[model samples]
Target: MTTMTDTSPREFKMPDVGEGLTEAEILKWYVQPGDTVTDGQVVCEVETAKAAVELPIPYDGVVRALHFPEGTTVDVGTSIIAVDVASGAAPAPASEAASASASAEKAAPATPAAPAAKPAPAAKKIEGRKPVLVGYGVAESSTKRRPRKGVPATAAPAEDTLYAAAAIQAVQGELNGHGHAPGGQRPLAKPPVRKLAKDLGVDLATITPSGPDGVITREDVHAAVAPPKAPEPVVEAPSAPAAPAVAPAPVASYDGARETRIPVKGVRKATAAAMVGSAFTAPHVTEFVTVDVTRTMKLVEELKQDRELAGLRVNPLLLIAKALLVAIKRHPDINASWDEAAQEIVVKHYVNLGIAAATPRGLIVPNIKDAHAKTLPQLAESLGELVSTAKEGRTSPAAMQGGTVTITNVGVFGIDTGTPILNPGESAILAVGSIKLQPWVHKGKVKARQVTTLALSFDHRLVDGELGSKVLADVAAILEQPKRLITWA
Candidate 1:
């Protein structure tokens, strides 16, 4: 191993892959300490609330340390890894080294006095440039410090060492109820920890920090919020010899043998929140119709043999999606969202068609942009790419936003029908049931034909019963008569 004498490590902060996302959980790390990395080499994969994204190192260097382990959710803009950019560089002059040692000793005293230490400095501003992922230009938010009494508007870089020392001392003072003076330095903690403390009404100044570098953690906040245990009763000794004390039962038992606990994070956590919000906020009205889609099924087979769509995916869903798009065109008011704040209804002229896909991580609804503009062949190609990318867990965050309507195909799993909920910010969702051969009257004769059930759920706040029914009836009519796709278009 080569030793560097005076080189400083470069810190690579976690980038916000999804705009406005506050934190991401690290899924895996590709490189470790002492591993050499080059520019644009992926070092880790992280999952934000929206999707999983791979982060690459911006410059070539040897990794010095990883700040957090896998599964830890870190705030955006926090340094996750440090790299020795100038490894094997020449040592500093003796005079410079001596001066550096003196400065270090002065800045970080053996016993820190919180009253004398200064606040840590704000991040340096790079004029005309914003913080970004390695290649993608992403927005970087300014660091948010907890509200303190007497912190200065700004601080110098030289105060960083003193701040660290003061933070360590503050942790000890927290136990003694003398953490920060009325106008002294603030306690050290991560953004999430601070938020948790705020939410639980716990004071950070009173909790002892257990994290490295004297930083407060989520567990510290929780411990502070919990009530202190009652002191055990002190029983008087009996005249006779005391009997053997019974061992207490285990306080908690791990049922690893019968049940496994999986942490809900990343995509799954976001999906749960969204689902709950959508369910409670929207008054959903569902309309169902069972249609004989024999002609649509026949057309799907015929499209599979067409030379123009030779490489594309042609399935019943493709036709059903087309029918829905046509139905929206006929009843444009159904393609709308209720703006609660504005007290208005937003009717969209364009269509962003979302398809609910189930992945190993969780269920995700990625949509096609401008679906109304795409032809049949183009739509098929887009659907093919969407399914392939979702299965590989590489769907981008942009592909999942701005959806005006959604389709959930429960038929794939042999479900007959389901009342689907609207995606948040969307007005309608169509659920397709399994298509099977059933006895039907064709030209006054009973015959076996392909039939399926379609259920359309809409936000009743803006979509009245009549409007919802018209859209559902239109979709069923088009599916039953496959030629309506061309006629309606």
Candidate 2:
């Protein structure tokens, strides 16, 4: 338990984890009320619009309370938790939560008994928090305070300011989330609650808070805004003839158990939006080419044994990526983004090669930065790391941002070629189908050779049929000859 004389709690406000992300939905809470928390400990995981991130508490203390529950979409800089840091209170156990709240309530004074006890309540009001950064301080807001009700109908700004300053001595106590309290105490509500009150023009100070302790809740705000509707006045009509009720139409039915409704959000949401835009805005033209890659498969096995590439991931994908890079080098026009506003085709000098990765979350295309400059071994290392990070769901937003081209290996799913949509802002995407042994003529003799279908989709607005065919043909030719990579690259 905290020192009996010092019952004040410190607040931990949500920090901006991403670039100007206004809000995030709290996915889970690691600590509950009265649970001891140390500085830099992960207290909660939040899923922002960009990605999921774990938030760490900045100071050691007993967790007095969690302000917002899990799944709550909290605004940046709002207090999400409160900690009691009185001396010897570092390790408060969960069982002590009720007793802790009772003590906090007892410590709270009904009114400003001393003439000196007054000032707007804030997280920064605690003296121990001076050593901490201001980012976690009470987030300042632009909303103007609704005038105090008891004040005279005239604006006596100077006199009111002077009188309040002379009486101010910042009240020290844990915040009661339930908003029902005396006029001296300001109503506590989450950002969304505050917004609701503002939109409905409901005065939070006037509503009796029904939330825990004394904080105002969404339901309380809503109740204040909209009360139960009064029943319609009963009008008894004398001797009215009743018409026969029409038979209800048979209700349509289906097996609810057989269907699943997964909410579209996060990576899936972004991919859907991009795909729709790319498909409709840019007319896609896909060309398919089946090639004999018997030599390429043999070369992949040989390179795996080479000392230079021993530790690297060598596969058909690795060689395919290299082949595409060589093809792009030969035809730089294909590696470009169309700038509609500028009314120009912006050709890129460098390639950020994107490899489509399928994670449990959704399909994500994280690109290998400056892929064109990397040697075969270096490219393999990057590709391996990208795949691993994506699988672990630890890929950062930056890794997926910029891209000039992409490759989707449908072969892993044992599927043949697909007309892959161009990743938005890029002109082309290469789809590699499953490679299988097939009958082919080698040196005027029929024999079984490794074969696969390759599909290259390009924005017809930028790439004509002739340019598209050459890029596809070049990639196929290099895969078939394997030795051509040395001469061409």
Candidate 3:
């Protein structure tokens, strides 16, 4: 019989869960050191640029250590947790068996080789490794909540150091008459509220408390700073000569001689490379057009009440995507990309429409595959899913690649219009601006209409100016009359 060696002590590294997202903050730990975790179980909650994501443990093992503390930030591909796999674990529970079978069915040819057979001694140990419960793993045992800072049940010098820092800041602020007076002192408010007061340029000592314990509530701060109403017009005498304006004190500079550094690990690093690649490689030309999209806005309001579109987010973006798809069909060349190394142009037969998402981490364009094939309702669903996934930082690598054309919704951030840089490998990107009420001359009469600006940036090498203009005009026409999309499509 073949002998098998124990495959214990597997380190679970943080995976690149989304499109080039580099770092994530641990929101909560689902498993602690010494806890047993089963394969495919949620081991922790982590916050990325997109959203809070639950990370699943990939091995059935005892958690050897938590490499990083909860609330600590860690880079992608770093080992966050380590586990000691049980030796001879029995086949996983029935549920896991069923899942494994399903996965096997879906897997393509050439799956990895199965684990080796083991001797009786190793088999017994492996059997011990079998999880006691079913599903991912037993839920972590609950314990009394521990304070985020200060003394812990376990004595540690680091905790004392943090406490000292807090104390020092408090003592210094007191000396400067900036913080609350000492002890019996006054209300019991947290440090954050005090910081908020400082930022708002409010004198916390002057504000009266309204809370049960005389604590100053956030509302109290707002009321104190509320702007005064317009005053009655008053005749005023000429003011005295203004004092010589001393140039505003130069803002305090950082200690440049004693250099401080921020490691480029996450979004900053990813954005730099993507922007550089796109700027230099793509031969870009931008064109702008203004359109009256009053009809499109009306249609959006109508769709918001429709039962079919209920629960799914219905926004101007959905219509914008639809118009772009229709326009691409009419002028297919605008959706084509230049392949410089191949000395050719790739005109994609199907549209994998990329929606440029501005995430906290950076700009990521995760595409909806075969978006051209999806119906309006289906497209809406896909768009919602794409954005939700992008925000949560779970957009897969596959979703970030092979985009044919992109749309940057700058309007969401209140931008009027911009010449968006093309997403690398994509031929065109359309910028959608904020819709505002503007006066327009229509049919010899000036009227208030909902207006928006559309900016289209295309690779000049692949898309001629004429084709680019046609695409923009087609999209504008559809928005001007929503019904035009149905006829054009």
Candidate 4:
């Protein structure tokens, strides 16, 4: 017997599944470290920018390890999961000349200088073939549907019986099953006429069908359901004596002493304390600016039509993120925070842009770390992942912390504008309002333009009036003329 050499194990990194999503939160795991997994088998659930998506295993092997915890946030290109291929399964070997010859013959031709590679030996052939990580692999058959629960087996009905039943049932059931009485009986009416009968509570069994095919039409149902007209009062009433008046009965009263009290837990409790601390510790100053965003709306429409962004969820919030990044670059001071305990003003070079998302739980500010370093496509992907994680209530503590500046899209709720509160430690928060069509003077002519309001709230001690105004103006300018974003970049 000839000996065989094992192929070297390969590490698989988490690929950038979307345009520029740098990281993803691990929602769940499908396979453990010791279990064998097939290529394309759903291995984990990850929350991305757009939605909570299930990621398929890219390799066929035994899972070697899981690098991160279930709720941990890991950067893209990080080795989150590892797989171990069994030894003695190298693609090519020296022995089994016949199999090697067949593989060589089947292999495609190469350049004149480079010879074609040999195939695996016959001894390496197994009962079942496993798929490779990359390129063309064995195609698995589609999954077949499993039998539904609680359904009983029965013999097939005859063809004539089926047809006769359908035809008779159509008439008896009044065209739709909803119009049928408790017992299966034909109301003397068609579907629409039966609807009128039911609305008027007319007993169809008491009425007669007057239309063709012995069907009761709308007029028949109306006539049957209509109430009889009242007769004129008789003059004999004037001869009768007047009746005596009666006193009204006393009304009962209820005690208003009882009260309802609900305990504050989870999101409510967390939000309350955060708001209180933020309000008291940080001196708040808010500034407002109204902008015409006709260009931004047009760009959003174009992005939605691009085939490259087929599966990605592109929205106005993405443009807002890009504008924020550009503004941060110009006015980095707005992206700093006040560290009270340290007795220092911590000015950061990088921007961890927080997005104040209103989730089912409560208000959460899950941020995109080092947002200024990301490209436009990446920012869009990151925004999608951040929103998705927030909605799912899976945002980690690390992601919720270390935010410098934030952008809250209040426009999504159809609100025009609001003075947004600062997130606990962050120095500034920007509120983007709803985009609406309003009459405006454009180029010496009256026209309908898309308008939105921007509200900036910052800590007075850190962000002064001039700095705050400049930052807010920068963001508004980008939105007003989207082409400015490219030049600013």
Candidate 5:
């Protein structure tokens, strides 16, 4: 929390809306400069990698300035809005606010060592106050300044003393995940930074923090892993003429009027990274089976008319999902994940059934918790809610986490079949192709039947050919003979 004077504007920083998220792009601002905002009122909506979230103002005040315009990505803990906290006071004009901010930035020291000194005095004023909110606090005590380490209380330079005071206040906030740790404490870093450090096999404690308040940032972790470069040697140019430099290949150019480029970020960017990682990390083996689903189609129609399934979305996908769940119950090992760090296959007792939905933002897979335990109607309701939420772009990050198995209905897009890549951390993904009328062998004769192809992609490391084949066969059998859903399930 930042300490505020009667006239000083209270700056609200961009918080980690989604846990571990490092930054977010400002989608829209609900309040503009000079606008009066009440406490807990949403000021802006931001799009994180996970989802879009609205940030609320912690204190009521007139908006003094918006630090960044829409579409700009701001780092977490960086101030994005400044509010005038004095009662009934109007905010400064946008130009004045911008000019004041620029002037403050220009007045800071050029050196990195005393950068914190500029904001130290204000922060120092609230050092002993107890926190009242996650990132906000109330001033309750006026405590004397503590001496800096290795510097006597009366001997340290004024600038050094101010820096130490600011650092102490920032470290206190770090306990709530905003700043750095004090001496002998765990290194302060965001969750994403910690994960990156682990991936690179770098110890956070060994790296020097460059972020405000001693926090270990992503750059710090990356620097620790980066090998130091040897100084380049200077070779005197030879007497002979230097060889003609090869011309770089002509840069590819496209007609500006005919071509369009879309920068991928937010959900699309995260999805692309996850797909690439899952494809390469998991050795995927997709098994395809074309089965007659005429009976399953009839069952769907019948269920739609049943009062118990009334107002429910009774479709082939619903039955397909149920069939997969039943197969998992019979062959419990199919619903399992490969734990590479543990070097083992961890089987799950409960299934979080993920349904892939393509929304305007991008493709998102939100799952239904304990889907295996839900009744047919309950499962349908959950699927309906999931689809609606995705369409509205309100799916929370938690809704997309902890998925065991996923089902992608490519059939709706009129695709015959597709070998879908498994969702990261999931062992299997079942793709449902377009169901259509086709000639099939039925009861001693060839007949026209509703047929569709099902593709099950599994991690080859845990699910062998035999296990994958069995799961696919069971699903096909249930679809072909819908009665088996009741008998086998």
Candidate 6:
């Protein structure tokens, strides 16, 4: 109920927690209004399209207000919390009496074009600071927030007006087309909306965005698809007799006893969109191979006993991953991405090997950087860390980007194998089946051997049958002859 006139408060805007992520759902608040917080203390956890991230308050202060409650999906750069750091100085007794008697308009502060800029002294504090989020766009700490010209000092501050201001500016820009910021960037729209516009053959630059902040929306896209027509013919039909009313069907409640509807959002929604885009956009061709990996299994066990890798993870997945990397090295052309815009096949020189990990929230594929260059021990360490981080739901968005190839170990769930859709922007995905003891001829005699099935799916536009087969065959060959890892690698 108290308003501070002595100091301007600081606002913690929602950071772009991932690459180009537009919005995030606030899941929980660790600190409420009136709670004291120190620098780097986590204040909230938000679920973005990629993952849930805990945002740490960057300075010491007492929280003035929580702008939005939990579960609000707020756009990035919007102030979500307000904090005051006037060295613990309480509001003056006279100011308190005035605040009590003051009208709402008199207490309301002027809205800054941006955040209440952080003081310049904290610059060195974050100078060497590495990003806590992997691949997330961190909001820059500002040294100044230019107040709109002619606003009086006595005017109160608007702590929660980030989205609203952007919207007003965006609308103005839309009305006056070609209104670009100092640095001319295109209008704002979600990736899917852009994709939809592309699919519908609609030009986004030509359309006037009706969404908040002049962002293009799906409805706007569909509207663009429909042909414009002159006002509908005004026909006054003779009054007709009303028909007898019929009984209507009762709609089922989402919260019914047996049925529950979960809102499509966060990682699952992103995964779905990516899957759909991959499936329809790219011509997917899946190939399968059943192999006896008894030797590979034995090698895995042997690696576990080795002194160097004693504490690291040693499993079929480790060997499978190594085998795939070796295969990619042999058939380098198979490791590529199809760039639709450039109309070129981008063959990557290095491998960002993605390991698809299933978590409580959703499935995430975090990759190991320069995996092709890693030795067996180094690869094992990275793989172990990737799995642990993914399972704990702490995997960074950066770890999932720029993957040239991916591996989904569906065998862990006891499934034989699956034709996994390619991860968006990647050429292929390999699915590993369950390693089981099955009857097979290993030395020209029927005997029990560790057998498994692998499914490789590739973008048909880039990978021809011969090339895809070579990659799959090489992976199988390495697993069939585990010693080949030494010879081939």
Number of the top lDDT candidate: 5
lDDT of 5 by residue, 273-339 (tens): 9999999999999999999999999999899999998887888989999999989998988899988
lDDT of 3 by residue, 1-489 (tens): 243444546666776554566887775676778987755445775655433445655446788888999768898878888887675442232333334434543563244233122133333433443222112222231111232332222211221232233222222121111233345133334333443555477766677768554666667777668876432222122452333233456665673355757655344656577778999988789999999999899999999999998888899999999999999999887778777779999888999999988654567788999999998889999999989766544454567778889999999888899989988888899999999999998779999999999999998888888999999999999999999988999
Name the 10 consecutive residues with the lowest summed lDDT in model 4: 150-159
TM-score of each: 0.64, 0.61, 0.58, 0.49, 0.65, 0.64
Error of 2 at 455 (Å): 0.8
Among residues 3 or more apart in sequence or in different chains, the pairs in candidate 1 whose N, CA or C atoms overlap within 3 Å are: none
Alpha-carbon deviation at 294 in model 5, angstroms: 0.9
Residue 291 displacement (Å), model 5: 0.3
Clashing pairs in 4: 20-378, 48-385, 49-384, 49-385
Q: Clashing residue pairs in candidate 5, if any? A: 174-179
> Candidate 4, after superposition: displacement of residue 67 in Å?
34
lDDT of each: 0.72, 0.70, 0.67, 0.64, 0.73, 0.72
**432 Cα displacement, candidate 4 (Å):** 0.9
Q: What is the lDDT of residue 416 in candidate 3?
A: 93
The residue ranges of model 1 lying beyond 4 angstroms of the native Cα positions read 1-8, 34-38, 60-62, 87-256
- After superposition, the stretches of candidate 5 with alpha carbons farther than 4 Å from their true spots are 1-6, 87-256
Full-model lDDT, candidate 3 = 0.67
Model 2 residue 71 lDDT?
Answer: 68
User: What would the per-residue lDDT of candidate 4 be over residues 370-429, giving only the tens digit for each residue?
Assistant: 999987777878888888766544455557767888888899899999998999778899
Model 3 TM: 0.58
Cα lDDT tens digits, model 2, 58-169, are 4467888899987688888788989886554332222233344445456764522321222232222332222111113322330122324432212112222321221111
Worst 10 residues of 2 by lDDT: 166-175
- What is candidate 1's lDDT per residue for 57-135, written digit by digit as tens? 6445789999999889999889999988653221222233345444544776563333233222222221223312211
